[model samples]
Target: MPDPVLLVLDTAPSPRLGRLTGRVDVRHADASSLAGLLPAADVLLVWDAASDAVRAAWPGPGRRPGWVHTAGVRVDRVLCPELAASDTVLTNARGVFERPVAEYVAGLVLAFAKDLPGAPELRGRARHREVQQVAGARAVVVGAGPVGREITRLLHGLGVRVALVGRTARRTIHGAADLDRLAARADWVIAAVPLTDATRGMFDRRFFGLLQPSARFISVGPVACVVRSGLQDALERRWFAGAALDVSEGEPPGPDGPSRDVPGLLLSPYPSGATVGWRDRLGEQFVALYEQWARGEPLPNVVDKERGYVPSADLPGGAGPDPGTGPRVNGSAAPPG
Candidate 1:
């Protein structure tokens, strides 16, 4: 058999992909080039999950790859009818980002709760202040994916009351309808949802208006979830305390991104997952998946195509084992890919 070919659909640094060269064939393609090159590869790593290229170019005249993996956790940007119905397997780098992102959100919560952003001025003064308890504060976390669950656990550890909202109503989680109640009462509103037709632009003026004036909204999902004008207007009028966003529909701000000069807002350049050990972890995940493939075993974290991703039923926490062992696929049931 020929060497396995993996097509990467994002702007990957040259050095980052050097390791895959010797074991698996690696090819790079952007959104514009995906259609012409997809048919030849055995796997596709969607580094840019938001790219519509795959969906636009899909339903080609022939067979597609055996498996597809997204670098990002959310599948809203990549899945469409053609890819969803195909038997070709799909997966995501589920655990790769959960903790780092959770940590980031925790930090943001801490910063807001402790008033750390206001520290610079206070440090010069001799006056002291009262520190508030982040513990026991109510946090309404939207989205029940692996990322949301991890965030929930982390928040619980921080003494925050967390309410998880998924597509369905569950014993432990609330459904979409309950979101308004949670948001209205929450001290912190964290949006960690996957982008779906139902979720796009869901955080509009009305959504922001529903929040208590003291609430803070932090978005960790795609940009479209919160409309630009809505959020900006909220900040402009102090409708809400502030927002910290790690993902955006239009990054680079001026290019249709949120171009606001709103006070109390904190933003980053999508650095939530850019941690020191991230690269090694990525390599580790792929290594474990490759091991399973070489042994003719099933994979972990398979994407559902129709549903965007399939969490491995084999996982104890729905995210598999710890990160150190490269995704913990050392058991039966072939692991989910």
Candidate 2:
């Protein structure tokens, strides 16, 4: 039998897969050429985690690779009904991004608190602003995954009181039921949750309305549920202090683009996970996983395809099986357990 074929959805700064060059039939394809290469492959590595190529071209059931791995934690880009229902084992780069993303959130909190970015821009116009102290701020971080935990850890290090919200309540973590209560008391609201059906539009009008007027909202991941018009309306009415979005609904405009026109809205092309030497780390991580795959060992970071993320139970410090907030997975609430 020939070597197992490895197909990669290539992007700029391609993963350095030299470690697998002689061991497998490694193939590379851009979005335009991906579908043509899916059938014969044994494994598919989604190197371009941000691209939707896989979602558009996932060959159904028997036609796809036996395993598919996304190089990022969120599998939203590649998740489709056909693939989710298939036997394919889906995995992600869970640990690789956690700390970097956490650091990004911390940096943003500091920048906002100290008025660093705003001060510089204001200084250009001979304006000076008072900076707030971060030592006593309170934060509510949605999503208790590795990324969320890391964010909580770093925020705590900075003396910020953090309340973590997961799908279910666990020791020291709040469930969805408590989000509104926590949001109303928080000074910072950070969204680090995965994009799923339940969480897709979670930060809607009602969610935003629950926040304190002095709170700053930061979305470190997809802004799936944050309706643009709702946010605009909130800003018009000065509902909250300000908002920052690393990811948006549509293609983000280029530098100095029209997205800057929105008052109290700060947008940055998603770079939370692109810290120094991150690519090298990603390449090393893939190589390690590739070795495990070659040895037929259980792969880590296996995503719960149905949930569109690595289930909480699979995470290192995650909550138990989702209690579905109100109680049962079914629509009925669990009897006062």
Candidate 3:
């Protein structure tokens, strides 16, 4: 058989595919060139995890790849009807980002609790003050996936109380019904949930209203009312005490750009998964999975496309499903994707 043609949707400092150079037929394409390149490829490595090029170009009349892999966790920007309905298999770099993102959350919690950003200004003015305590603080973490669980663990280590909420109830995890009540009592509300219809606008007006005025909301993925303008509105109206948004609906200001001008609204360029050598980590992960695919082995981190993410039950070595919910197969028997 011929070497599998691996078409990588290119991004800067492209994937270090040197390991597979001679073993696979590697091709490169960007948004403008993806459409013409899709037909002949046997596999597509969506290296540009944030691009919508794959969604826009996947439906054209031609043979599609047998497998698609994204370098990141969330698959929202790449999923479309054609790709979702096809027999083509989809995979993601799920475990790659969990701890790094969780650590970022911990840093945010510390920054907010200790008022790190305001420290320089206060020091310059020689002002002394007391900041709130992180230990003994209450946190409500949404999403029960690996990333969410890791965040909960880190926060718990810091002596913060945490209530973990997921799509449905399980042994120790809370279900969706308790979110509002939990948020009402929490000092911090951290969202690590995937972007599905069920979770998309789940944090809108009513959700924000449930948070304590002193609560700080931080989202690793997209959250409703946490986007650019929405955050501005919340700050202007004094809806909540403060917030940290890692993902937003619009471009973030550049490094030398003006201040957001809105107090208590922290903005980050979505670097939750961007630790040093992280891209290299992702490349190494893809190469290992690629080797498995080349040998026809059962792949890990298979995404339940219909659900838009890799279901918790489908994670590598995941326990077969929560007792109440039936076995998770392609998310067909699971809750809303």
Candidate 4:
């Protein structure tokens, strides 16, 4: 019953929840301030799932909620020794973000290809140079998750041949063994991989060295995917073309900082999936999932604590997290075909 489903979530930016008035018992509380309220709810809506609070306080005195859902992508914050071992059925807003983020990656690739962000001011006639075309560029999208796959599909739409890599080798998808070879030939290296123990700081020197001087790197996942030191090396040496990151090892790149001084790096405060309809879709996801949960139906987009996410069952529903590259953050963007 909606009454038992304590919607213990941070307030959202969507007007869509205006319709869910008396159907559910919604308790709005910030993560830090949820000391006394969590135990009463049967299900807690962890809208801000990235917070340490979810993991810090769990199974509260044998009164924790039976189910918990996060609004964003990447459950690195959600899964841990205690939480994963519990009977709580963990699910995420997987279908909400894949395409929107794919669209964002496409935009960044186009921007870099054309130098749209920091172009040499077209007005002044002091220096007129030739503009380059992006038609024949090679783009490598890391991670074979939904988000990465979506990025690959979008790049392919632009005529860029994309090679996909996943954890295990399979038909049509490359495994870790093939990454370096793929990176070597790419004109654009997109980091759409997840943040697992195997992938943290995975974007180090060797990966950067593989890129051509003309290749750009775009990250739409956790910052930890790209080591800060390695990125600095590539920028300084111009080892590759440039980079546009939606996620970073250290975000809000310190004012008057290295990212600002870097020649070709275009850094923003991680806004890849901060678009319209995002919050509404999150609320919509909750509404739909609750419908299924109440009916005792098996929940879709379940998170596998061991592997982090349940593998994709069909073409549309596996391992999608938004960084929601903002709405949902990373992982899911558009499902990889």
Native-referenced Cα lDDT, model 4: 0.70
**Order of candidates by lDDT, top first?**
3, 2, 1, 4
Q: What's the residue-level lDDT of 70 in candidate 3?
A: 91
Give per-residue CA lDDT, model 2, range 1-337, as digits (tens).
Answer: 7989999886764557887777899888899999989998899988888788888888865667988988777788888888898999999887787787888888888888887777656645755556788877889888777777778777877888788787777665777788889999999999888877777767877778888898998887776646666776777678998888775323455442225567888776557787787777877888888899899999888887877777655454322223432111222111000
Question: Positional deviation of 242 in candidate 3, in angstroms?
Answer: 0.5
Single out the weakest 10-residue window by summed lDDT for candidate 1: 328-337
Cα lDDT tens digits for candidate 4, 1-337: 2365465567453455555567767677676666567777777777765565777667544777788888777777777677788888888877667787888888888877666775667676545555567777776677776677667666776777677777655655666788888889887888877677778888888878888988888878877677877888888898987887774322456652335667777765545675776777888888788878877899888887777764564545323322323112123222221
Compared to the true structure, candidate 2 yields what TM-score?
0.88
lDDT of 3 by residue, 1-337 (tens): 8888999997664556889988899999999999999989999999888787998899554598989999888788788888988989999988888888888999999998888888777745656677888999999888777777778777877888888887776656777777788899999999888877666766666667777778888888754324455555666677888888675322345433214677787877656788888889999999999989989998888888877777776444232223333222122122222
TM-score (all chains, Cα) for each model = 0.84, 0.88, 0.88, 0.85
By lDDT, is 1 or 2 better?
A: 2
Error of 2 at 321 (Å): 22
Total backbone collisions, model 4: 20
RMSD in angstroms, candidate 4?
Answer: 5.6
**lDDT (Cα, tens digit) per residue for candidate 1, span 1-337:** 7778888887654345565667788888887888888988888877665566777876554768888876667676678777877777877777888788888899999988788888887857666677678987888988766667677777877888888776666445667778888999998998887666677888899989989888999888777777988898888899888898884433556756666466877886566876787756766676677668757899888765554555433445444233442222222221101
Give the worst 10-residue stretch by lDDT in candidate 3: 327-336
How does each model score on lDDT?
Answer: 0.73, 0.76, 0.77, 0.70
Q: Of the candidates numbered 1 and 4, which has the greater TM-score value?
A: 4
Cα deviation in Å at residue 28, candidate 1?
A: 3.7
